[model samples]
Target: MAKNLLPMDALIAGYLHEAVQDAGITYRKLAAVTGMSINRIGIILRQESPPATLGEIGMIGSAVGLTASELVERAENVARTRQDYDLVANDSINEFPEGNDADYDHA
Candidate 1:
């Protein structure tokens, strides 16, 4: 079986789509409920454009009966789990070469 990997943004978008459907809220109605413009709500529903701020996320989560913290944690979890091997190479490491501190200093 081929490995299937999805981006965090796509995962979050899918989650929002499911949450809205489960809550029985249409996108237009959600716009009214959240006091965000239809265009903005469309962007959110599309999931291509994530909520710009924590406040925006709070509004969405509240409408879907989710806590803001819960939504944030879910997004973080998706991001954490979706990393590829390439990301491992970029992770921070503590190893440093030993050298004279005075020689490295330039002023």
Candidate 2:
């Protein structure tokens, strides 16, 4: 059986939302700058749908003052953190018993 994975589209949308908020810009302004329709921007930012292409991501990132690479890198970091948490949560249960002095590396 395959393990369930979080959707990358949602992660990217979440990062984009945070970036837009941090930039202190409105959707109308972003639409105007990126030459994108407000509804399309809404779809992407709200995670109603993923952007159709890398060019769309680029346009959105540029409008929000982030490079495409930077935007993706940050989203990737978020994904990694979530994956790590899921793994630890799933695997660590009952691994440590009461009064057990097992040496473990905390790196």
Candidate 3:
């Protein structure tokens, strides 16, 4: 399996994407206004390589007429929702591996 990464990042990205959708605006418009790129938008949406930076989020908030605090709060709420989803999806999840540390070098 691939290494596990925190799911909150993806949740935050999804929140931003949903906001754009709610505004009936395309990422291109946001891209032009915020000097962001469509390709990067996908990354932001997926919380992949192009995950949102604080500056990026601020720029997007400005374009969407959201206060900085409001935007951040929304992002946080979305992340929580995503966490809930992840918990449901991985009901039998383990947060860390179990093993005898002496067996091998651990990073």
Candidate 4:
């Protein structure tokens, strides 16, 4: 079975969607500006896929006139206001994989 997405994923997507709207950027315009595909942008904005990668977040943020750090900070602020923020934040940490040296091996 496909794993369910973390609440953080939806939260981030919602934040991005609002930011894009506030910036007056359509998905097509954002795609053109960021050199990303509309389908990918739609997937990210609509929460149809997993949370975006750091690189993708940066691209999207740039298109919306925000830095990646700023975008993430804003998202965290939004998360903090939710009643289940603690549960969602802790769950995200618990779900992350712990890695050792071998996990980063290139050879």
User: Which runs in model 3 stand beyond 4 Å of their true positions?
Assistant: 1-5, 77-107
| Native-referenced Cα lDDT, model 2 | 0.73
lDDT over C-alpha atoms for residue 79 of model 2? 68
Top of the candidates by TM-score: 4
How close is every model to the real structure, measured as TM-score?
Answer: 0.60, 0.65, 0.58, 0.71
- In candidate 3, position 1 carries an lDDT of 47
* Native RMSD of candidate 4 (Å): 4.9
Stretches of candidate 4 above 4 Å error?
1-4, 86-107
Over the stretch 17-63, how does candidate 1's per-residue lDDT look in tens digits?
77888989987888888998888766766765443355766787788
Q: Considering lDDT, which of the candidate structures 3 and 4 is the better prediction for this target?
A: 4
User: Which numbered prediction scores highest in lDDT against the true structure?
Assistant: 4
User: Which candidate model has the greater lDDT, 1 or 3?
Assistant: 3
Q: Could you tell me which residue pairs clash in candidate 3?
A: none
Q: What is the lDDT of residue 49 in candidate 1?
A: 47
Query: On a 0 to 1 TM-score scale, where does candidate 4 land against the true structure?
Result: 0.71
1-107 in candidate 3: lDDT tens per residue?
43333464555566667777788778889889889888877677666754477787677767777655676676567656664455233644543456644655576
Q: Can you give the lDDT of residue 102 in candidate 3?
A: 60
